[model samples]
Target: MRITKIRATPVAVPYRTDETWAFGSRSGMVSVLVELDTDEGIVGLGEAAAYPSAEIVLSVLKSVERLVVGADPFRIEQLIQRIDVVGTWHHVKATSPAIAAVEAACWDIVGKACGQPLVNLFGGRFRDSVEFFYYVAAPDPDTVKAEGTRATAAGFTTCYLKVGSDSLDIDIERVAALRDGIGPHMNIRIDANEAWTAGTALRAVRAMLPYGLELVEQPVSGRNLQQLAYVRGRMDVPMLANEACWTRYDQLSVIHNGAADVLSVDNQMDGGLLNLKRSAGLCAAAGMTVLKHSLGELGVALAAATHVIAATPNFRHANQAYGALLSDDIVDGFGGGVDNYRDGCLDVPTGPGIGVALDPDRVARYARLYREHGDTEFSFQHPRALTTGLALPKH
Candidate 1:
């Protein structure tokens, strides 16, 4: 089927506000939803991270229409390369979510055309359902303890906490509260999102040893791979690499340096679903495990991640924001509401393609939220630093 048209809309997905946020508050969350239409009556959907500039991503996606429109949707691999070639002629970079969304849509079309799920495009399902770690918002120690307690009661086996941006003592207290509230059986992970210096990060992580945190993510800056290796060498717990690594090239550096024990892969950040799987394969070959990284859910990207994780054997539990923590989303069922995480596991959609159907009206409503409010809330990598009275860790 030939791609007839490409469309992108900016949407503002609402999350917890400042009053409820733990680490730092994000006032808004901006994302872009991409829809590709083909002549054969097949429509493919994709979501881009759209950090720093969702409007820029919208423009970027539309600017590459020449390379995608009228091209065979089946020629996905070739088209991915063609985006770079076409954009170079105009001095524009199309390799971001612009090209990634198109690439993902093409894959969705392929799966739908073949009358099979996206997992079938890979070998098959490793397990019937993929497990998920309960994502707690950026909240206070008491708030975190409550979230952990609720997570344990809900039957979630693992919980991922958003930490950092406070004093090492406060962060530790948050960890201690969670451990005390949830008991000994549950697995707890801390996500710093690159908020501390190497030395301070190592110190903070070491202090939390008594609480039994499963792993600490991106403790230091992404650029500090050597320091990361240094910390991992000293600490026994597996360190998960998030911002430091997105592709296999970055994975190679971390793996070669013995930096991180686990590799976290995100379809949005890594470019596409196939790209994430390819990176997971690279990590597997190197004898390292991959974690399906969800910086946050944009709905469409989460659906893509679920399919990719279902086929990927390297990761046991994928991380994403779901349940009541997130107030609004572009999709009604796939990322939140009925199809969201239940008891720490999300069932794979058995329908054709990625098993998600987008609601255009809802998409338009969120798109209006973006157009009117212009929320600058992006990814955790570039979170707005807290410079007030709170004792944020010094890098």
Candidate 2:
């Protein structure tokens, strides 16, 4: 059926705690929720993470309205091709989240029409449930330890922490505290987010080796594959490529250069759910593991990616999610807080399409929240952070 209309709503959902990273901090998640209404009276849902900003995502949706409207929802590839080629959004990475939201909505419509879940259409169930890591917000050593204890108590097997702070000594202390809190059983994964030089990465990782890291993510910049490979060769811990592999083309280069043992893939960053599956297949061919990377998504986006991750093989490790941090969600019973997870895993929704429906009350609440405070509170660029100069490689 043809798409009749597209409605895009920007929502800001508060986090339990501020998500502090190497560059900046955001108090919550800001997403552009997309709804595609079809001629056959079918409506599909999609969610786009406000990558750079909600304004950009809204502008992208407006720009592609002509390309998306009056298009066949079933012919997703063709529709995406038009948006990429005809709309000239192919080269712009920032436009991807909006494009991906449209594509995901189309897939949702297709699944509903076929009376099948997205996992079945993608390749059936390689797994019944998808595992996700508990996100530990970087704070003081004691707070980090407390978060680790909370994650462990919640039955999560893996915990993800952001490193590459202003001081390596502080990062080391935090890691040590997390290890102490989680005890010896659980895994600790750290993401530097391309905040260190190769030399500094080596020194920093070496210092934290005693705490036992599961994987070190993007210790150096993603631009230089040789530098990544250099760090990978010298370190015993496995490396996960994040910024280095945003697209399939980047994934190919990472494979060729042996830049990482695992790759981080995101449909929001690339194009859509289909490309996310393609990313997994590409990494599988290279005998490398891949995990989903989040730009802070809510239930709609989380459920869409869950369907793909559950159906795909080689996603052996726990993927990333904002479960530990999201204070609430717009969707009803899935993917908001730690309560929704069973030992760090989310059961795939068995309903047709993406299978998670939005709660109108919560949606309106968060939508109003977005309108009132999205610019200041939910922003990725903190006002204080803008005044301070950021020198990369944190040496």
Clashing pairs in 2: none
lDDT of 2 at 199: 91
Could you give candidate 2's per-residue lDDT for residues 1-395 as a string of tens digits?
89999999999999999987878787888999999999999999999998888999999999999989999999999999999999998898867999999999999999999998999999999999999999999589999999999999999999999988669999999999999999998999999999999998999889999999999999999999999999999998999999999999999999999999999999999999999999999999999899999888999999999999999998989999999999999887787799999999999999999998999999999999999989777877656446543665566
Which stretches of candidate 1 lie above 4 Å from their native place? 17-24, 88-95, 322-324, 337-339, 376-393
Off by over 4 Å in 2: none
> By TM-score, who's the top model here?
2
> For candidate 1, what's the RMSD?
3.2
Q: Give the number of the best model, judged by lDDT.
A: 2
Clashes of each: 3, 0
TM-score of 2: 0.98
Displacement of residue 10 (Cα, Å) in model 1 is: 1.4
Clashing pairs in 1: 21-138, 22-138, 22-139
